[model samples]
Target: MTKNEWEQDLEQRELEKKAHNRGYRAGVKTEGEASKRVELLENVLLEFVGYDDKCLQTKPGLLKRKRADLVDQIIYQRQLMRELYNHLDDDVRLKLRTKVESHIWPVTHSED
Candidate 1:
C-alpha cells in the first residue's frame, strides 16, 4: 500500500482499538455495578431471614417475594457478567481476571 494508504489504515485500526477498549471498560463497569447489587441484596435477605426462617414465622409471603426478587437480581447479574465476558476482548478479559486475582475487586473500569 502507498504511504498515505498505510497511514489511513493505521488510523482506522487505532480507532477500532479505542472503540473495543471502550466497550470492554463499559462491560467491566456494568458487571461491577451488578455485582454490588447482588451483594447488597444478599445482605438484606440475610438480615430478613435472620428475623425469621419460615413463612409462618416471618411476615407472611413478603419474605418469599423478597427472596425471589433477590434471586432474579442474582440471575440478571450473572447474565450481565456473562454478556460482558462474551463481548469483551481476550486481553481485556485477562485484565479483569487479574483484578479478580489481585483481590482489588474493581468497582468500575469505564473510561469516564
Candidate 2:
C-alpha cells in the first residue's frame, strides 16, 4: 500500500479505538456514580439508625421497639449495598468491598 493509504488506515483505526474507549469509560463512570449513590444512601441509613438507637437508649420505654427498627434499617441498608455491589463492575465492586471491609470489619468484630 502507498504511504498515504497506510496513514489513512492508521488514522481510521485510531479513531475507532478512541471511540470504543470513550464508550467503555463512560459506562464505567456511570457505574461508579451509581455505586457512589448507593454508598451515600447506606451512610445516611446508618447515621439515621445510629441516631435512632441513641435516642431510644435514652428512653427506656421505647427501647425494644427502637431496637427492632434499628435492626430492620441495618438489614435494608446491607441489602442495598449488596445490590449496588452486584451492579458495579468487578474492579469497582472489589475496591468498594475492600474499603468497606477495612473500615467496617474491625468495628464489627470489636467488643464494646
Please tell me which predicted candidate would have the highest TM-score against the true structure: 1
What are the models' TM-scores? 0.45, 0.38
Cα-lDDT of candidate 1: 0.70
For model 2, how does the per-residue alpha-carbon lDDT over 5-103 read when each residue is reduced to its tens digit?
A: 999999999999999999999999999867756754555566556666653333453354446455655677678767767899989888777777767
Backbone clashes for every candidate come to: 0, 0
The per-residue C-alpha lDDT of model 2 at residue 36 equals 54
The lDDT, on a scale of 0 to 1, for candidate 2 is 0.70
Residue 94 displacement (Å), model 2: 47
Model 2 pairs in collision: none
lDDT of 1 by residue, 54-96 (tens): 4222455446555756576567657666876889999999987
lDDT of each: 0.70, 0.70
